[model samples]
Target: MNANLQRVIVLSLLILLMAATRSHVFSHFTPVPDASWAVFFIGGFYLRNWSRWAFPLLMVLAVAIDYAVITNQGMSFWSHYCVSPGYWFLVPAHLAMWVGGFWLRRNYSGASVASLARLAFSFVAATALCHLLAQGGFYWLSNSVAEPTFAGWAKNYGDWFAPYLQGTAMFVTLAALAQVVGEQISRHAHPFARRMKH
Candidate 1:
């Protein structure tokens, strides 16, 4: 396939995955877990060349999905609990995830132990930064907290960090496995195609 066509296919799949899994209500009714974070990360890795348009597109999609869900629940989008001044901070928070994948792509050499280590480190670092910006913005600026303090923020971050990390890691790992399998198949297929052409 043409490289651009492959990118479009990947981008479409990522968007579909995000849309399908982003809503808590949707996920609650379905077996699929939220793949929003993974979508951004994978998008950064595979669609980095199109980041200028793709990132903003995904961000808009995310906000639009949130709006739909909140309004569908009979709540005004602006009046919803999750929609606050701090909600806009999600831009930076999610950018961190994108950057992580971008970094990984830049450093990725192949499917090797060293590359896998880099992937682990980059992903965890990105997840940590993303969570800090997201949780800090909510704790300090959202007004949802009655008595926000450093200690309270620390505890809140601690409570949610593991689950978010685990979830993102699970999806990323699955993507990694799929990529390896695809590469192996392509490698075998290319040799056969070349022989057939001769």
Candidate 2:
């Protein structure tokens, strides 16, 4: 397949995955955790060359999904609890994840212990930065908190940080495993295919 075509197919799949799992829109039918964070990370790794368009497209899709879900629940988009001035901070937060993946792609040198270490470090750093921006914005600027203080923010950040990191890590780990398996299958299949052709 053409490289561009492959990228397009991958991007489409990522978009579909994000749309399907971003919220409880279909929770009654099937419960699935949100894949938004992992989608952005994977997108950054696989579609980095198309970031000029891909990132914004994914960001818009995320906001659109949130809007649909909130409105579907019979709540106004702006009036929803999650929608606040700080909600816009998600742009930077998610961008951090994308940047992390981009860095990982740049440093990736195939399957090796060093590469695995880089992956772990990159993901943890990115998740930490993402949580900082997202949670800090929500806590300090959202007005949802009553009399916010540094202590309160610290507590709030600490409370949710681990869960968010764990969730993102879970999806990212699964994606990494899938990529490794796909590469292995492709590597083994190509030789067989060529031999059959000969």
After superposing all C-alphas onto the true structure, candidate 2 shows an RMSD in angstroms of 2.6
TM-score of each: 0.94, 0.91
Q: Cα RMSDs of all predictions? A: 1.8, 2.6
Model 2 Cα lDDT, one tens digit per residue, 74-152: 9899987677898999999989999999899998867678988999999999889988998898888886787999999
Q: What is the per-residue lDDT of model 1 for residues 1-198, given as tens digits with 9 covering 90 to 100?
A: 788998999899998888888987333345666778888888888888999999999999999999998889898999876778888988999999999999999998678889889889989999999989888888888877988989999999999888788877888999899888888898899999999999
Measured with C-alpha atoms, the lDDT of residue 85 in candidate 2 is: 92
Off by over 4 Å in 1: 25-31
Best by lDDT: 1
The count of backbone overlaps in candidate 1 is 0
Q: Give candidate 2's TM-score.
A: 0.91
| Number of the top TM-score candidate | 1
> Against the hidden true structure, what lDDT does model 1 obtain?
0.87
